[model samples]
Target: MINAINLNSKLEIQAEAFIRFYYEETKKSAQQYKERLSEVAAEIRETGTYTHTKQELTFGAKVAWRNSAKCIGRLFWDSLEVFDERSAKTEEEIAAALLRHIEHATNGGRIRPTLTAFAPQKPEGSDIRIWNHQLIRYAGYRTPDGVVGDPASVELTEAIQRLGWTGQGTKYDVLPLVVQIGSRKPKWFPIPGEAVMEVKFEHPDIEELAGLGLQWYAVPILSDMALNVGGVRYTAAPFNGWYMGTEIGARNLADADRYDELPAIADLLDLDRSTNTTLWKDRALLELNSAVIHSFKTNGVSIVDHHTAAEQFMRFMKREQEQGRDVNARWSWLIPPMSPAATPVWHRNDLTEREIDPDYAPQERPY
Candidate 1:
């Protein structure tokens, strides 16, 4: 419950652990660490909470990303570009900053790992929050047949529609950025069309697959999650890294609950989908993953294949090992969705998934 944390004796204990880790990582002097700890304690005694310095905010965010046990992309955790927007109070300011973040992180197709943290939550009052699961996502409309877009976004898409967002009713309609400051009514700001970057899918060899016309956004900036730095809860922090090919191909497009393009893809491939023994789904998934990887590389958008990403994750583990630090990882998540048996991480018998401080965590939905 990092998001719903209250001022209590445990607050100081958690804050101390985070600060101590920060000092050890930064190699700051012992005296400076002690003084800062004292200051933090006094501030908590007086105001029930304390503010993080700019350096603390940035470094703590990177640490949070590094501590995300479920993320296979943690190899690039230290390279996260942190944008501190803690001073934003108005919806306009927050919206403008979000737009700016998209533009900067998009980086003209070479997506960068980036995060922007807004004002932290108070002890009791309105807090800055963004309702969208991701800064960029397609709307889902529940039609008679099924969901027309990303089924994962049905609740949010319906929520926005009720809020007076009249979409074009298209399969890939970009959802508006929903922002809320405290108890005020949430506001929906339509993102400028050009700000969002997408890569259209085109198979390298299967020419007929192009006729399906699939595309996915370049950067996946998760907006609804919270970042806990020490004991301070920055509830409006959004962060993203370039996606692994399997994430889009194996899961988003192939999963039955998501876009469910497997049957369509199998039809294009002329595979024997008559029975599960034919393994048509597996063949279709391979081609789909190949197309996603090929399309992204052809368009110059940064995306890594599952195998390469796994290699990088191993490197990250080795680097942490040299420092005598345990690499907390979730085995199931670290294994690629497409070919779990093909990756080294999948063969491991032990994988620890423990909660670490200064980490990214899910918060109670504001909507």
Candidate 2:
């Protein structure tokens, strides 16, 4: 009984913290929301709970995206479509909403950045979680010789398997969604194939590359992160954005820890692998980046190259200054991994990390 009382007291504190943060971030007249604030305070006093209005919810979600330090894609932060799914408390309802998210973000190949904000954490209820790293991701499997899939997904793949879900262990196997409702056991839901759009990467110059069978999804929908709107934490808010070519070409496909296809790509080009000075790696990287950009363009999918993306980010910064908003960013992320000197962001030292309200953050994993 004492524990319950302490939990209720903590909830009241959290509610008040969230209220203060929200009012400050939104910059709306407090007098206009006096009645709403009073109602929230009353609910916290009685039931130890509170809710946000749709306007507040939308504004919070957008600002969170804007404050994302690691996202170079914040140039389109205002373009994010926020889907308030606070009512999706059940596992089935959440699964249905995820499907809708996939379909909408795919957007018939012209991917759209979208966010689905679920219920906030409650004192008495369990927090909802999507265990998958992304709504759509390839599975990684542990094998006798070596890892047969994406090494990054190996942990989540095993977790999904523990939840009674299995994948074919192919080079490109879409993993099932592991949805958990509060303290209840997690369940797996298979995504409809039609909702996911993938493009096979083939270099414009290399005709034989198509036979290698490499493809990537049109949108990257990250699902594991928590969305902290003001002080209110939403554990199941999944968000997505259109791909940046280098993210796929340089990191996911080229990284030694990831796909590690650079060696094979170099070999196919018949380049000298005998020494590091041959510039084989550079040549291979260019071809890979070209393949990704060309494939997306051929498939009529929306994708941005690193150079162009950096240029757009400069425009975003200028616009933010005009609006009298501080542009906080992570320099390492704002610069592309493939070619740092080629882009203007490389020379800029203005990017710095700062504490900002309403941001998406990484959650601590249960050990």
lDDT of 1 by residue, 254-331 (tens): 899999999999998888888999999999999999999999999999999989898999999999899898888888
Model 2 scores a C-alpha lDDT of 0.83
lDDT of 2 by residue, 65-140 (tens): 8889888888899898989999986888999999999999888888888999899888687999898888999898
Best by lDDT: 1
**Collision count of model 1:** 1
Candidate 2 shows a clash count of: 0
Best by TM-score: 1
The clash count of every prediction, one per candidate, is: 1, 0
Q: Which pairs of residues clash in candidate 2, taking residues 3 or more apart in a chain or in different chains?
A: none
Task: Report lDDT (Cα) of residue 69, candidate 1.
Answer: 83
Candidate 2, 209: how far from true, in Å? Answer: 1.5
Q: For each candidate, what is the lDDT? A: 0.89, 0.83
Kindly give the stretch of ten consecutive residues in candidate 1 with the minimal lDDT sum.
1-10
